[model samples]
Target: MSEVQKYTIADVASRNGRGGAPVWLIYKDSVYDVTSYIPEHPGGDVILEEAGKDCTKAFDDVDHSSDAVTVLKKYKIGEIVEEEKKYDANGKKKKRVVAAAPENSGNRSCMNKITCGLLG
Candidate 1:
C-alpha cells in the first residue's frame, strides 16, 4: 500500500479559518480541508464551531446522512500521525493511562483501621 500522508494535530490547527487560512478539522483520525465547502455547508456557519480540532463526536452526534459522509470523505487530506490518533487500527478508542492516586503513608492506614474498630 502507498504510504499515507500524515499530519500532526498542530498542522491541522494551523489551517484554522482565521483571516484567509483554510478551514481544516479532524474527524476521527482523518483531517479534512473544509475551506472550500464552507459556503455550501447546509448548516451554514455552524460548521465553524469545531474548526481546527477533532469533531468526531459532534459529527457522529449529528447523525449525518450517507451523502454527507460521502462528501466528507472527498475533503480528507491526510491521516493524523499514528501516535496522535484517538482510535486504533480497528477504530476502537484507545484507553488513556491516568495517573494513579498517591500512596498513603502507613500511618494513615493504621490510624484508619484503629478508628474503624473503635467506631464498630
Candidate 2:
C-alpha cells in the first residue's frame, strides 16, 4: 500500500496561491488542495479568505451535507504533520490546530475566527 503524505502547517502555509502553486487548507487534520474549487465555491471567494490555513470550524459552521463532505475527499492530498497538533491544559490533543497566518495578513483575531471561531 502507498503511504499517505503528511504536511506541516508551515509547509501548507507556504503554498498559498504563490508561484503558481495551489492553495491548501486543513479540515479535521486533513490537508486539502481546494484551488480548483475556489472559482466554483458556492460561497464565492470566502474560501480563499482562509487559504493555507485550517478551516475546520468555518466549514463545520456551514453544516455541509454528507454529499458535500464526500466531495471534499477528492481534494485530500495529505494529513497534518504530528508536530502541528495542539494540546489543551489537561494535555489532551485538540481536534483542530489553527495554522498561523502570514505576517502581512491583517488582524490575527480575524484569522483566528476564520479557523476556530470567536472563542477569544
TM-scores for all candidates?
0.77, 0.67
Please name the candidate that would achieve the greatest lDDT relative to the true structure.
1
- Each prediction's Cα RMSD? 3.7, 15.6
Local accuracy of candidate 1 as per-residue lDDT tens digits, 3-93: 7789999998888888888999898799999999999999998888899889889999999999999999999989999889998777678
Task: Give the per-residue lDDT digits (tens) of candidate 2, residues 79-105.
Answer: 887777554445444777579866765
For model 1, the run of ten residues with the poorest summed lDDT:
102-111
Number of clashing pairs per prediction, in order: 0, 0
Cα deviation in Å at residue 1, candidate 2?
Answer: 1.5
Q: Which ranges of candidate 2 are over 4 A from the true structure?
A: 86-120
TM-score leader: 1
lDDT of 1 at 52: 88
